[model samples]
Target: MSWLALWLLGAGLCDLAHSVRPARHLPSAVGAAGTLLFGLLAGLSSGADLAALPLLAGAVAGWGYLVTFGFGRGRAPMALAGYAVVTGLLLLIAQQAGAVGGAFGRWVESTPLPVLAERDPEQVLLLLAVLVAQMSTGNVIVRLVLAATGTVNPGKGPDATSTLKGGRLLGPMERVFIVGLGVAGHATAASIVVAAKGLLRWPELQARRDAATGPSIDDVTEYFLVGSFVSWLWALGGLVLLA
Candidate 1:
């Protein structure tokens, strides 16, 4: 029943809500609840029975519980890995969802929401979910990776990755651009975007080498590289789903 799309929609909404409040350690119960509500609406609107409710609610709850209990602990890497594995599993199964499928997709097509009604609703919903997830959830996921794998510091924090600025904003913009390009059949052009980021940040990295505080030059570089790669992968993964 469009489990993949439904889960992505739920996870995206959860991250979005958390991002708005700007709290990393906070739980995403609201988003979880939102998922259930969307499921219920989609089911009812599409004239489907409520039999899928138990599974739907359980899945959303489990995801929410994982994310809610995972962060801010010493197990960031483990938690991140778990999340990735689940996402991959979902993506694998998403293909099994037949066309015109997912009560959500049908319900979306039934709406008077202009533009949205005319296209493949499942694709649109999935695309929208990816875009929304990239906006906030992408940043959070990168942060999780950085927190665990950031460069080593003897007397300082593991990462102290706040040396470079504007990444939170820049990462999302670049990801959206890449996803859009991929979806538009210009995937090869994404290399330009990748190159552009390195060129643009070269000066900042150089300047950080002489900075009086924060992570060392190498640490900052590692932070940038790791975060950037993760962000790119997240975006590319979404593009793959679209493909």
Candidate 2:
């Protein structure tokens, strides 16, 4: 669980760093350093075995670096998804060995909150990490999926996002809302909210249908559907991972 959380944290922070500066190597370097530092913290706190720290840290750093360096390539999304699948396998092996909780579990018991603070520390940490991922990392994945699916052409330059506008921001907000509702045990409500997004964006999509510039209505509609569905699945999948 800790490893998965760390992977998510590394991904989200790496994407945020790249979005902030978009440098050739700065974001990867920052993410790797941050992941390693956090790995050391986990070891020191006995949240993970000392002997396993090196391997865990290596995984986090390697994946983080790859995320920064893999963007814009044809197979980048597939590669990233493959790494996620591998991480899941690693997590299963790690859990089978023994309990993953330690000092963080103890710390959670010490928290003042009656509800949230009483929950598992790894859960809380992962929730925070997923929320962060929903911001930038999710957007990155959606764009990659859009490109991969031909809904938007990355090679052609300026995908629907540039024309659609507000997607990069609206996406995070919507995903966070859905995740929050899920956490609050309002899955049905969350689904309703997800449905409302299409309605809310209907006018905008309709407006594009009659436009003379920017992405075509067909392209924009596909972008909306694909991106929204990807984001929804990502948020839901994160919850499943936490489980």
Candidate 3:
């Protein structure tokens, strides 16, 4: 396994652990720390295996931006969409930049030490698909499950998603279920990407005004649905170019 992948996997685990405990700020703090640690580790691990580093860095940057700027007060569907897009863009930009050296500066220099270079085109494409799904679903599940379980309580007043601000939505068993669901969702998306382009297309486009005609079920359905679709699209693009 790539060192950057290991570090990121570890950090993601830490974030999950922190979400388990709501009484203490330690969980959130640990999560933030884990994000930063993953970024640094990615930079250090890049070497010649640049792709791994970008995936890790993108995840870290996405989480970092969400934690830093904070989401809007209203659960307005548009606001939520904006938030998700911004987070996704931050991650994508960071991953692309750091992986192949865009604007973050060349943090990793080539060296002569033997490294486990994964050159299989098919494997590389699969890895990219899995990595994107992992980060996106991991994040969404954390929030939804945490809120559902009462591990984190939605704050008083009108916010989107749930009724609690901070708490795990489900218990240990349910949390496991969430993780499983995330993995399954990733696989499902990948299969769709590999199968048909039409399978990934979303709901029909709506006029800006007609968008509000419904009960706004779009809040929950849109992000995950569109997100999963887009991630696979990204993976497909990578696969066509690389694989």
The TM-score leader among the candidates is 2
Better of 1 and 3 by lDDT: 1
Report the alpha-carbon TM-score of model 3 versus the true structure.
0.33
Badly placed stretches (over 4 Å) of model 3 are: 1-15, 44-83, 91-96, 100-243
By lDDT, the best candidate is 1
lDDT of each: 0.70, 0.69, 0.37
For all predicted structures, in order, the TM-scores are 0.78, 0.82, 0.33
Better of 2 and 3 by lDDT: 2
- lDDT for each residue of candidate 2 in 60-159, tens digit (9 for 90 to 100): 5565566654565576677568567757776786563323345555666687876567566667767877788888888877877776676764124554
**lDDT: worst 10-residue window of model 3:** 163-172
Local accuracy of candidate 3 as per-residue lDDT tens digits, 42-79: 44334434454444444444443343233333222333
When sorted by TM-score, best at the front, the candidate numbers are 2, 1, 3
> Stretches of candidate 2 above 4 Å error?
43-48, 96-106, 153-162
List the lowest-lDDT window of 10 residues for candidate 1.
Answer: 44-53
